[model samples]
Target: MSNFVFVLDTNKQPLDPIHPGQARRLLSSKKAAVYRRYPFTIILKHLSLEPNSTPSQIKIDPGAKVTGLALLQGDKVIWGAELTHRGFAIRDALLTRGSFRRGRRSRKTRYRQARFLNRTRPQGWLPPSLLSRVENILTWVKRLIKFCPVSSIVSELVRFNTQLMQDPTRQKEGYQQGTLYQYEVREYVLEKWGRKCAYCGVKNVPLEVEHIHPRSRGGSNRPSNLTLACVPCNQAKGNQDIRDFLSSKPDLLKRILSQAKRPLADAAAVNSTRYALLNALKKLGLPVTTGTGGQTKYNRAVQGVSKTHWHDAALVGETPQLQFLTNNPLLITAKGHGVRQRVITDKYGLPKQHRGRFKLSHGFKTGDIVKASIPKGKYAGHYDGLRIAIRTKPSFALYPKNGGKQFDTHCKYLNTIHKADGFAFSFVGGDSSSA
Candidate 1:
């Protein structure tokens, strides 16, 4: 067979803490933008499991471990490996440069035109025009900071738009980044609890996701069957009398009873691309800021007028109306950081957990930890009235933050000891019984 090798940069540490397939995952992450700290020379190996030695012997692909060789070449190979499989994508894989042009039919142009067209009449969007004209008109006259000049602004604006307009091609790669996303999910699982059985809370960073219901026995990636477990845990829970993975961990089962049990707060930011937008904005030399999103403005006149007139209505010149960077750019959450609050309640409104017994949608097992909230009663201070519970969810869902810390309205129910007023009970099955 044949092999492919790579010489990676010496800077980046092991990103995911796992061994094999590290390079594929790393390069797949943060696409197009290279991680300067970590670089690598990939080695691809073309091999056949059955050595029939003929033209029709066989051909291999990415998922086939036997067909690929993922090596950690700090300097030399600890174990012998010559070839690597075709694991596409790298941190620095540049998008083929093209003339970025603005056409009447393009999405950016459509939004800009729509914004300008929408201005013909107000959609009751402007809260109080009378108040706006009164306050903003006066504000604009008093504070006139000296930028280079409008001529300079106009010139720069022209240059930027000209550059943006250079790209004319309209072909969608549709960007099938699933392979990369798959790698990320694997890394997240391994890094969270090592290689131990997730149900039993055993650490085995090297463990793989064992199907509690193996495909051979009729299982899909529906989540319940898929669990993090060592090779041995997987083997032990084989087909014969395979019970649910949750039965293994007492802590995970208990989270349901110990939790505040309320709705979630606003959305959190987690995707790596928003960070890309943040960085790109800074590199463009704008007084870049992190934020969720806000009402979009277009007119060269109104947009300019709004920022100059109002503080909250920020001014983004003729640069990239970067709304395209995000999937849901229209729903602007906040200006600085796109943090969303779910449902915040005053302490007076919070519900008290029943002291004696409580039940959860899920049950409590072992290896559970109880987290409590600081009660508002006499023991509120110094965690005196603190009550703990186990987590019930298999895995919690959290959004990524654009900047600072993003707190949710519903977050009072999670990652905290508190819960909403209507919510009763105090138990979480995850790591709580053990906690």
Candidate 2:
């Protein structure tokens, strides 16, 4: 057009009315310009303060929130920090040091300051609450009606609870906080459940936690977040809400939500997820002949089904293996692991703990080495090891620690030269080997 110079599209979303995407510059420097002022700024949380910064740093604090500004920059981060005030030499150094020391607690201070100092702006095209409702409606409608109503090719619908992400800590694990809807659902269940198992009245057994809101429909994992479920009840309940879990019953979702308790409503939510499995031996679905109740080897049957059922597993005859960053960070999820654990062995222990799923956050080349530490136990000291590829199914691959596989249960889990600290390992070289 005219003589306007162009460089790159800097995301200029405002931090407040004074500034949008220019938070770093506006907050740090006065000369920086902001187009808007007095805006309703969202307080973003860092999903993970300690993210996959570098291939060397795998398995960060896991507790650190990743919903901060300086996020998704990958691991090569200096830190999500800024230098506020400085006198000259002495004052500057002190300010820098203080920034590093505040830790997670400082995030609260940032929130207080932002809320008090920043001006709230009026909604333009969309209000956050309305937008969130739209998202919920779309999600439910898609499930009930199928397909999102009115869509753009570039529009990407993220998970629910996007607003909670402003806080950096919860950001890392995907803004996974319990919501008001979830709380309402839980309260409804407890009210209906008379404080004990409906069928057995046994209160001591570790209760199974479930959601009236199906996990597939953006449900989250939390306490007011869940309902009491016994193994026997759960097996019968499956994935469907309570009514669907039982036949000839009406859908309870609405009554459950409105009745304010999970159990009492005639059509309220209950469990009805189907656990379907067929033995290769019987067309009528003959149960296995191996385990206590004639079930196939636990791991073999559920190897790829920790997240889902065997019929829904990725592979037909084989198990799906955990993907790694080449030989870097191991993919891990915080739920239902037994379904996957049975794959390593055929033993079927009682389903006791919460499910743990495998998750691979990032990938690395063969040459990229990751620095990891022993999570717990005797191997408290850190060491180093080479990475060797552990090939499972041709389609699935994972790289176990090279040199010696110490993390293995078969005694190799220990190191020869034990240091007071835990062990370290790398992808390629760069101090990736134990001397």
Candidate 3:
């Protein structure tokens, strides 16, 4: 299965999305034409159609780094995408700017007034790092709703249970008597050990459920006795006592034993902004339903699907018995518009050089997407971006958008397709030309 192809009537009015096969038939018979590449939309050439649509739902699994999105009509998943955000990038950029500013202030300069508590954050204000994730999801949702007739939206508001995850039996018999079951113990042990061998700490190795105390030597099958060890470590340990084996590294053994009894803390930092996202989605005026991380995991386990963001999205929120989903989802990386104003600077905040102007000599901005066609020149294909190193009248070098090969072309044959709206374009396994 693949994404549903968007359809439009001859008058350019929106219509119901059809299967990719149907869209192919229409295109082959010259009944429809390609409209967009990223979303794979199509438009009718001569056929007149009414504005009718089927009830559809959009499911979003929001996360700090990667968000999963899926559009479904009943039990069939028509389109799916994994949106990778640049939250860390935003954070790192701000930190770098702050470091530069601090360095500049410390250098030999006139004394300035000491600031004290002058800045204040507005209501509902979130750091750019966290807010970027919410905005990216919202932007995609808005764009999708415009193309498809989405009736309802489903999103994962809270991923994990903070209390239950931190102390699995917090409500039960308190800390000392709270013991996890065998299966639960294994999961907790793996996480506590960082999914690595407790003996060697080598990650990415196949780990085995090993007993810290030899089971033959009266070691109970409790979580405290259970630990993760690689195949070599388990074989070497055999039935030997753990104390005798790890006598050289008392600290490592003690750390492993202590951590096995304690549960890993929930990621409260990343989940802090989930409520803001939920409220923003609700403001869209759609009937929104929220799910939990446990429910999503249960749904995926019951369906026996492999772990992936898009698969989790398909399994989220009132899933049917049988659902059709795409094998390859569209990969969307949210690269924000290059908004860096600083031109050049050395490592120690010393200014090396600066850009004289923002626009190129040919009047094209740095991020504008342009198409260039040269009848007889070195460069002839489509190129985008404002990497015009030589802005001479005859030809100019163009850096391609979405990490493409840069090429040189003449300005006379350049045509503007879509102006860069503070965003970059990079897609794979879809149509390339624009409408």
Best-fitting candidate, scored by lDDT: 3
User: TM-score per candidate, in order?
Assistant: 0.23, 0.17, 0.75
Tell me the lDDT of model 3 at 384: 34
Error of 1 at 351 (Å): 19
Task: Report RMSD (Å) for each prediction in the order shown.
Answer: 27.3, 26.0, 5.7
Q: Candidate 2 residues 1-435, lDDT tens each?
A: 001011111242212111233444433564343221111122222222322211111011100111010111122211111111111233343454445444424544332222354676663323331222222222222221111111111011111223253455655334443333333334345445544554345686766556645576665564333556677876676666554653453434443344333334211111110011111112222221211100112222444322121111111111234221112111111111112332231122123454324322123222222233445665444444332222221111212354344332212232222111111222223323311
Worst 10 residues of 1 by lDDT: 56-65
User: Best by TM-score, which number?
Assistant: 3
Give one digit per residue, the lDDT tens place, for model 1 in 1-435. Answer: 111212122332112112225445645663212321101133223222332211100000011011111111122111111111111211111111111122333534422332444446544232221222222212211111110000111101110012112334422221212323344334333333343565456552457766555788766553223457667766776764343544665566454222213211111111212232233334433243222111112322343432211111222232222111111101101011111323332333222442323323244311122232333543232211122232344322222222223111121333332221111111111111111
Query: lDDT at 280 for candidate 3?
Result: 96
272-301: candidate 3 lDDT, tens digit per residue: 678889899999999999876666776777
Arrange candidates by lDDT, highest first: which order?
A: 3, 2, 1
Against the true structure, candidate 2 reaches a TM-score of 0.17
